[model samples]
Target: MELSRRGFMKAAGAGVAATSLGAMGFGGAEAAVIAHVRPMKLASTTETRNTCTYCSVACGIIMYSKGDVRKGERAELVHVEGDADHPTNLGTLCPKGAALKDFVRAETRLRQPMHRRPGSDRFEPISWDAALDRIARLMKDDRDANFLASNADGVPVNRWATTGMLAASATTNETAWATFKVAKTLGIVGFDNQARV
Candidate 1:
């Protein structure tokens, strides 16, 4: 049924009154908000780019520097985000990639080699030099024991006693090159570098 002019005016006035009451908290607006709301803390920050080390995906990541931590300086890397402009991710990242910053700064990072004697309850830290020397010595001894100077037909072969090559990735260029040199000295035939792919 068509509302008379006076009736329409009355209805409009009622609607306005209800809205005002809700705005002023005279109605149950606050209760409605509380039922559907939760408190939130905000961060002030920005972004930057860094490579991904996790899988082979190598999606680009953006780091967000948040809340000021220093007396006069701005916050540093308070968060990490995905780089949308990166061709690989198109501005998206998997869970692992997204949390890259946290993983990098984790307190449990292994900063040094830890050695634990058999049956020992704890691990003792060791210097990198010592570790490298020990590994070199062990590898040398193994090669010496396995020296295979001949092929299947007994022809002279200069190859190492074993496969005669070492291969690995997950290292910087210089380090990988150094590793290649060491492997060559030991007559290693198989070689691989992470940078290959």
Candidate 2:
């Protein structure tokens, strides 16, 4: 007996039919799965609109929360698409920007501050006060020892030591401001950073 295309598929298992349809570049159960998985969902709580932090072009984000803020109720973020109302990113987001929610809401985030003593092999839990105090002391010592208030010919220049301002490019504006303020307080005016002109 000869089998037609539909008869052949019906004889085979649904899985085989699905595979054959895919091979022929046709829609099947797999396509149905993709179509059903919508980006937006009717979450229980309201959404808080925010911006993505991956690049200078901040994209809009909707943070879904289910319960009271203090009680810590269930929250799930659905989509990270760009906000149409945003001036910088008009309803468009790059792959990295779209993955911001995963990064922020990950369980691997540091719960508390940590500190590793000088020449120590590992970081240990420490209070914020202790960590800040240790950092202040280290900064003071380094500034006093390496600070240079003049050029090579000692022309009474206002420049600090080259190693004074240890800056990196990945810092945000708020972080940079705090670091700069601390460095300046220690008379560390020699600024060199990843974003240096």
The sequence of per-residue lDDT tens digits that candidate 1 reaches over residues 1-197 is: 99899999999999999898888877676878778875542234655677677765567777877654555665656677777888888878888887777887789988799888789999999999988998788777877887677889999765674554434443445866888888777677656554454
Clashes per candidate, residues 3 or more apart or on different chains: 8, 0
- Lowest summed lDDT over 10 consecutive residues: which window, candidate 1? 163-172
* Candidate 2 whole-model C-alpha lDDT, 0 to 1: 0.68
**TM per model?**
0.50, 0.53
lDDT of 2 at 79: 44
TM-score for candidate 2, please give it.
0.53
lDDT of each: 0.73, 0.68
**Per-residue lDDT tens digits of candidate 2, residues 1-197?**
89899987777777887778887758676678778887655455576777675554445655655556566755555545557776666777788877876876789867578987789999899988988898778776776777767778978655446455657544457877888887776566676665553
Over 4 Å off, model 2: 1-51, 56-62, 70-79, 152-154, 162-197
Of the candidates shown, which would achieve the greatest TM-score relative to the real structure? 2
